[model samples]
Target: MSSLTPGVSRLSQPPTTAALTARSSTPVAERAAQVRFRRAISLMAMTLVAPGTAQLVAGNRRVGLVAFRTYLGILALGAVMVVAVALDHGLALGLAVNTTLLFWLNLALIGAAIGWAALFFDAWRIGQPLSYSMGHRRVAVGLNGVLALGVAGVLLFSAHIVSVQRDFILATFGDGAASDATHGRYNVLLAGGDSGAGRWGLRTDSLTVASIDEQTGKTVLIGLPRNMANFPFAEGSIMAEQFPDGFDCDDCMLNGVSTWAQDNPTLFEGSDHPGMDATVMAVEGITGLEINYWAMVNLEGFKELVDAVGGVTLDVKDDIPIGLPGDEVTGTIEAGTRKLDGFETLWYARARYGSDDYSRMARQKCVMNAMLQQVSPASAVKNFQGIAKATSDMVETSIPASEVDTFLDLGMKAKSQQVATVSLVPPLINTAEPDIALVHRTIRAAIDKSEGKQPAQTTKKAEAGSKAKADTGTDAPPTSTTSTTGGSVGSMKDGYAANESEDLATAC
Candidate 1:
């Protein structure tokens, strides 16, 4: 038997070959049917989810639910196809179209929010029940018409909502937004102070420095501890200096200066220093960056801004217990991602309990990052109205109205880039006692380093000049400026850099 060739044995086993062929064919047929069934199921599921005939069965009136559903179906299908093409081929054209459609849809929804308030209130619907008593139903019909007209009027007048919102967007990221090269390059100081709501006094409780670099397209955020003292006032003066002839009264702490300027408008004329300008200049002096502009917003504005954006989602970087008014009202936020409404976001920014101002600044920056993420195109589509309203009410900036277009262009261009953050930690700069003189020195040195300017000794000159001016109200000559490297200032050491900015380098 072994001598017989293998081919001769196969020739004798044709039946086996037939059986194997049949078995293979059967499985192929079965698999084909299975694939068909899966395709059918997928189609059915899509139909069910779509706004279509099913909507008519759901009993929606006024506008035909079926038609509305059909429109949504078209929108959804288009979005799906667009996304698929974009992903599979990285088609810029397809993405552009898809984004445009989404933008329009978002705009429509925003418009609808203002226009459809009456629908929620039932004012646009007929007041009378649908019945056979037709002749007298005219009253209800008339009433409905009047209500609809009123609602339309509201929508017309409410147009400012979106405009204000666009303005706000312009302020933060800059106008045109598409070309935001300066997105994270410059530093914008955010302050949380008490203002409005019957109490008009303003004092910055929290200070945050946001740095955005246009060349690097990175954002660096640093939060300073409010308690860290030794802020430079004049030369020997540990407290704020008296007002210069043209400057506002410098009697209060840096935080209180804005409020003082607001009250003494005459002295601070043409100088909004008591408000955002002064704060910005001080921050510029400390950081050594020429601040482009500043925005000042208080608690009331903060709440309003957050509320307008509906709410923002945030990642809990650490466990923080927030105390509310009733009892020891406390909330422990674990380290994770969570959705935060306006009130909670506000609380997160303003929270100081069991945390230092440094911690608060970190939280504030975190919240801001989260906010930028939330307002991304996809999320913006879902919450345009809220975002628009919040932006309109909460933002105040010095960016010119004419330059909004340029800012917007910049913003849109840099939308997808990574955001960078910068902070001056210990070894570079650290907390110290509230000695105005020491602070001035450190600040001057930092500024000099940033500007590539000469580092001279000015601490003693500043002190002497400050004392002489305090006594005689006379200004110091450029030659009288104290040396910062090794100078005599009462008993303090001389390490502060010389004041070089002649325009603003005057000691108190």
Candidate 2:
């Protein structure tokens, strides 16, 4: 046609076979390339959705069947566990504190991670990357690697966290049998203790009893000052036998009970922690509530616990000094509602430069309240390792492994309620010779109020403020005749404003 163009006034004819092939070859090639690329991605995707499905169809069937069976078995076991936990919730808790179970769980996770990763690699190999274009091969490999690493990384991380939890439970929780609640309440003695060279061994500077309702979980925090004196021990207790009538020795304050027990351990037979047992006796005697368990925290190492929970938020009523009396001040916690770090929170709870011990007790109560209310479950999970490490290192408790989950649930319940507090400090009760009868009655009333068995009573701080205002015929803060303590909002002579409050949050 080209040569005879002038004479080729003839009509156009159908395209030649070569021309047709030339026209369709590029499009056909592109479509074939697309099909191969799609097949590669589909194989990888099948592995992601159902771990050995790609291999079952396109690769070795034996390996695929084994992997698929393992995957199904794991899923079925998980479903069975969910049903078991639903029937007996305590089974989950038992597993949580079970080191043996945790160990096996860790192993299973690791094995699953390795097996799943192998399946992904096998699926990748079956994709036959060489059959695809260079660009398609690169994309498919990247996707396979991401999927493998992501799944393996998650499983490995879970194993690591579970391993940490197991270690923590092993070291921190004891294998003692759980104790039943006393009178539908569980009373736990919490103390902040310290020990050092050339110092009295294990002196608890802060002592408080958290009496929790067995059903409702409402709590009454009864704080006994470290300086409290002339208290009796529970009848038939070692301390009681030692001091037939009461602990009336000169300079033998409440906090010294632990040191005294440590000095004479022979008196506390069958007890691993003689000092803790002695303190429990004293707290039981003072509060008239049986101690279900005790948890003592090392004051120096408590900062780690605070930091582990991402620091607790507190209201700093005054500028609190970081150092003890006569020591060089390093930092100051300024007044106002503040979120405090570990160091600052430790000082806030222990600071007493210008403030007295009573104010420190009040501040410690504030810290306990803040920790209970502000520490969310999300924070616990996010900082689980830090928390586990800190607790293992800092806390010494007699809580049985079985009771850990019960208390955890109770604590969650308490967090939503307004906590009631009563510290046996000045004005309300004389620390030097505290009225034992009054202490018993006060503790009973607080617990009753928490259980809703008794009507609400005004806090001692309110009563003192009213009395002071009545005396002065003014509505000013009860700062009459003296200025406020350096680190507290109220004077030592007047009751600590935070000592006995119906609602601790506002009182602090």
Candidate 3:
């Protein structure tokens, strides 16, 4: 009862409250100064750890705005990645795009970080011995040491990023797959598949040959129509041999064979054509060029990649407003130079109905040209992080990362070079429908001529008098050449002689 009656002790007097009030009554300017100093220290610490924080430290309003934008952007992108990688969508179209944006943004952040450190050095320079007394030299040296250490740390991390990326490319695509010795002049056959994203299963939806010659500094893009007929597999090779029926004279269309490869995974490895080795060989046989690298991408992945770049622009040849089975519908647009969003562009590329396959091929090439042109240094700098993110999420290729820089260098060098486009239309290269057999072998020979490769040398007669007899209409003797099959030329499981005989007749 006594404790309850005694409410306030001397120690618990209202003096503590008065003291707090007095402290709170300090001048607003002084309080503000203290708060600002505390904030500066906090920001510096945070900036050192988070790349985006460079904006706050560099005193670069433009970079600061970019960093702040990226901070929020990354959070949103992370959510999209989660949806694409974890949810049922599993790197769905939307998520893949978000991831790409994140990549480009992240790259920009790295550049910003380096800039911030440099800014700090500049600030320190303002008070250096060069401008002041010897006494201030020690302070300047100490500050320089600190700045150097910070810069070294940032560079170390940037190196790690590059190393990780290189390792990833090598593991996924095989080392030096895109090297000049292996993939001369940068003519890469790229095929986009249908699988959504990140999944192992995929098929070629958009097929093209991307060629670049650094010596001449030109990049040429050639699209291949999916329905082009009379595509041959290597003699008794993997793609044709996987059919288990020996080389099928009936299976001439490449797309059907690809579909067949998809349905029978045991015969193939993944959901793609097992005969791509053969396909490349066939292209070599036709184009007469030594094709060294091949890349396959999925349509979903391509769409995601395009969107990740905030969409691409292209000059339209004509108004395209049509819908097709198994294709996403892009709405109508006026013909002229125009920007294409992801789905719209994809649909436009796939809009080949009523148009010949050659026309479709041309459209695809147009899209690629637009994309490459759009990849300006400014665009790359602006959307660096987003590009990295999308590349991780939306693509799977056989080209390794170490080779990426080499390829990019070659690309940059060739950005201004003139390019040649070739298409094998009706009379040039004929493939019969249903049976899908080639009627002429010279066409394949001509393709080789274009690619700077010579045709198989013909045996000379005993005497000049043996001057080649008048050519007959019948097929010529077997010639050693590249095969569309998975094995090397002349290694067919079936009797090599018989297979070669058939190859000579088709000449694909």
Candidate 4:
């Protein structure tokens, strides 16, 4: 409406940018309302940085005091955790593997999330948002929601991560007394399981004992050929009781020891996995090293694990076959330095189409070494869920839940150390009639050499050369030649190049 009085001007307010922005005609009541609205917004924002501050200044002082104290306590706890971790780097690993503690931590996170969201809501209420203009009120609500949900969402996600770790630990490790280190060493049996390590009617496709120093983390991977025959059993063990002289039965091989024991369950009456027990006994008898724990991997699961890590990098020496010698070819992983996917990696480790058992064993060591070095802690964390799922699927272990942190630490340390391998195959220790005394001395010598206790034994003199001469030997390494028997780089008469390596990394 136009002004009727003389010299009257416009009645409507100017644009928002012009209103009260260096103005002289603005009303006191309207300006006061604006000030209160600004004050309300300021209080809400204070709660975002310092929870309960808004309530302390304007609403409930007691509630604000409680929330503020709780917040301070949490901050102090976090600081303490940081200091503890600084002192002991393995402290977080302990917490991660501890299922009981993880359960509590996850619950605490959930509770903290709820409490934090509640405090944000309280701050919004204390802002007196209803008294503000509708637009201001909407802004206040939106900002309050962002703060509340943002913190809660982060904490909720943390809780979920904790839950995943707890589940993986619980599922993988069993409740048992942790095996103490033997002579300052932890010897764990690594095998490929057709069924599972702890189940009935199982046979190991591959076997390697990962003997590690408890203090230095130096490791020796002793690869036992699956076809090893006529081996003695550890004294006083059930296998020894059955075959006092030696396991010299017709067609009896090293891998069949498990199946043989499982057939006569009465011998291992109280044992869940008689086959595994027998295999461990045989391994102990052969190596003279005490076995602490065992881990078995399913081939299918092994592929998944490799895939989970994005793939394993390998020095593919030749065109590795994918299927058995007699079977039609499924695929081939060509020679040269290549990063192979899960399927390709699995074949690289297991393919025996043209390769002999010993050659395959050599390749197995290569894969193990690659995994130990390349699949890093960072990668594990980055692909945490995939790795966890793959690990649980493919691997079965006898390691106690308590010892997980110890192995986790040891594995990390092992990456920094030189990994050596000893394979009891042709040209070193004959599989058909292996010199039992020589085998023991060879293994001990390897371990001793690794520990700087003794000098390395020469290939001609030693029964099982500690050096991987078969795979990466001086004579033109394994390549596509007439001498290349099967798919591997060496002939059947001599042995596979990978059968033994002084440093597995160099051999592969």
Candidate 5:
């Protein structure tokens, strides 16, 4: 009312003490906000660097201590595993294959992930993010949520993968210790079985003994014709006792032994795998080497395994037929170097049209060599899940889970070495009546050659034939002759038919 001086009015007065206090406090509020933003950032960083540190410093001590200890233990275990893997791969594999250990480890991973996520949430609470300015608070929440989910999600996913692998191993392998290697080698009998309609049990079509050196992993494959007859069983085996005079029945062949044993289960009583056991005895008697373990690959299932590894590449030597017996020919696999799918590979290995069993055996050996050489470690790791599924579905083995690591190591070593093969076919040994003593001597010599103790001994016919071809400067006409050693000579040009050579690759 007294504001008649100049332009002054009662409504327009200067700032009072309270209003000034508020104005001056604006800078202080801004400074507080800045400090809070920094604190929020630092707390999140602490949680990231070392989970539960904020809880230890400002929140619940018990939860913080537990989480911190667990984190430290996990780090320690990871470091120890890295060191162990670097020092001894077999030790790492052993731990991986141990189902009990894998189960506990998977559980620990899940638990740790949950505990770590809880610690992150507690850390955010300890930071008092809600007390901060809106911008700072939002940033803090976002970061905390991200970190919690990220750490927990990754660990949970890894746990799932480990669980899958553990289940696969547990389901696939039986409980037993690894068999002992004999004569500085482990002889694994690899048989390919066909389960067609009306085929009683599994009719083993391919028989090969992979003799692997215990130390160097140098391997020799000894292929036996499925038609071989009049063979004795391993001296102390049940089959040997039953047929002391040898498997000499008029209609009984080597491959028939498995079916006969299955039909007459009482003959192989107390044996869990009577068919495979009987076949193992026949193989042992024929090869004259102890069979440490046996694996039968279902040929139909083998296709899946091949496809799982992304198909195998091989040099096809001849046009192979692809069709069932007594069925119309679907197609023919043209001869060339090509990558083959599961179906094509199966046909390539099992085709009997325009070929005999001996030639098929040679082709199978080539397939085995190609697989061993071509499946690289990188490719295997990339396709681990598919390969695991295929192997579990296709293969039936007596090899135990505990021995997986040792065999894995040996397989890796074997990959670096050359594979030698010896097939006892028509020109080498008569399948009608195999010379048991001569078979033992030949197998021993092949093993010695593989170990570098002896030279490769080519047959006289092969030597003479090669010399005649060289002398003539043209292909020698095919001829057959009965030898004094009870073997029949045949053409070597026809895809290693009834021929034995030091190098299977060149022989075929």
Candidate 6:
């Protein structure tokens, strides 16, 4: 009993200095670890809130200051740009299209991204994560690494997009000043050219002048047939001086003007795009509108562009051939509403077999209208890279890069409105012997109708014609005496006419 009591007493006695020190140091170590964990968390939070602040507070002052200043400067510049865009769109567009500026902007973005990422890493290093628990250290490292990658990745991607846009702008548009609207409208000549092996320059196969109202975006598509002859040139143009009378020589059709200019380049000395310039003058004279700009799309390249956007949906009305003229037919596009790829859409716009040029022109107008209506802004952004590449490869335009935003706005407005079309062909205006005065009158009426300046004619003759068609179960021919807006001259089944209908879709 005595021995057991002593053993118990010894066990219950006060601890030694070594044992006490070990027990006390355990708690001290734990507290130190907690303090380090809290510091790391605070530093990471600071870095997230203000990118360089963590480094400024703990790591490297000079690096932090430079990064923070750059960040502030970029933010300020962005705010200014947003305000500028809101106030003056043209100025914003001008800056966006400036290649030299874009290049520097890209480099700046890359530098900022690298600097910001480095700052994050430095902040992580300064947090002394090694002194923390395994879990806490892992979390800190993960957050810092993710932030660094995110910041760098976003800016680098933005730089890439900007670079693509810059390249596209440089490739597609020439150094041409934006032209002023003439008579409250911007008359733009759009031509589709075929660049075959033996062709001299590109043949202006498809020619249309889109006369757009400056305020309302109301448009009138005035199509001139490639086969039209005896057309005059705009006054004071070199073509006018050369062909003093009309282009009345044998085989001197409207489209031939381009080839002629190309062949006789000396005749158009000092002109950069002699063929395009001459063609523009001819179209201006025929339509009685001053052209603000001209854009020529290479048809073959156009196909690639369409494919790049995935494809275009078009309401195909008839069976169209897909082969060169007088050659064995390769395929047939069945008639229906379908989404067509680049090649198919190209044929839809250019097919001529078992069809005449006049009909082809009407189909082309349909293609144009479909594209205008379907290509929304969201889709454009989503497919921007592909579109940029395609546009740069396909189109050559005198339109300034500064004016692109303006046109985009106009196009958006135009999409909401009905597209009106007028073709200078067939029984309405004899293409072989075009009456210049009548052509001008037809164009003006179409424009007026489109702008709502003039009421579209709803003739009793048209109602009677409809009734007659229903009664007879046969399509009624367009009445000769019909006094419509542009003068109803042809049925869709027969051939394309100058004054088909106020609404092109309805006419077709």
The alpha-carbon RMSD values of the candidates against the true structure, listed in the order shown, are 19.4, 5.2, 17.6, 5.5, 5.2, 5.7
Q: Model 5, range 119-210, lDDT digits (tens) per residue?
A: 78877777777667788788888888999999999999889878878977877676766789997899999988886676523688888999
Candidate 6, residues 1-508, lDDT tens digits: the string is 5555644777787799999999999899878988987887787777766777777888878877876776687789899989988997657656766788899989988887887787778887897888877888888888888988998999999899889999998888877788989989998999988866765245898899988888888788888899999889999988899888989998889878898889889988888889999999898888889899999988888888788777888767677778869888899887788999999999988877766677678778877877887788788889888999989878999998778767876887898887788788765678988888777777777777777776344333345677988999998875433221111223433445433456765554
Q: How many clashing pairs in candidate 5? A: 0
- What's the TM-score of every candidate structure? 0.48, 0.85, 0.52, 0.86, 0.84, 0.83
Number of clashing pairs per prediction, in order: 46, 0, 34, 9, 0, 0
Q: List the residue pairs that clash in candidate 5.
A: none
Candidate 1's C-alpha runs over 4 A off are 1-187, 196-201, 232-253, 307-310, 324-327, 330-335, 413-415, 424-428, 433-508
User: What lDDT tens digits, residue by residue, belong to model 2 across residues 142-226?
Assistant: 9989999999999999999999999998788778989999999998899898746654237989999998888878888899988
Model 3 regions lying over 4 Å from their true place: 1-186, 196-202, 240-252, 262-275, 281-288, 325-330, 433-508
Q: Candidate 4: lDDT over CA atoms?
A: 0.82
User: Who is ahead in lDDT, 3 or 5?
Assistant: 5
Please identify model 4 stretches exceeding 4 Å from their true place.
Answer: 1-41, 195-201, 455-460, 463-492
Q: On a 0 to 100 scale, what is the lDDT of residue 488 in model 5? A: 15
The number of residue pairs in model 4 that clash at the backbone is 9
Better of 3 and 6 by TM-score: 6
lDDT of 2 at 378: 91
| Residue-level lDDT for 339 in candidate 5 | 96
Candidate lDDT values, in order: 0.47, 0.84, 0.50, 0.82, 0.79, 0.79
Q: Give per-residue CA lDDT, model 3, range 141-213, as digits (tens).
A: 6655576467757755665455444333433454443456424365677766666434343345556666565
**Predicted model with the maximum TM-score:** 4
- What is the C-alpha local distance difference test score of candidate 3? 0.50
True-vs-predicted CA distance for residue 492, candidate 4, Å:
4.3
Q: Residue 166 of candidate 5: its Cα lDDT?
A: 90
Model 6 weakest lDDT span, ten residues long: 480-489
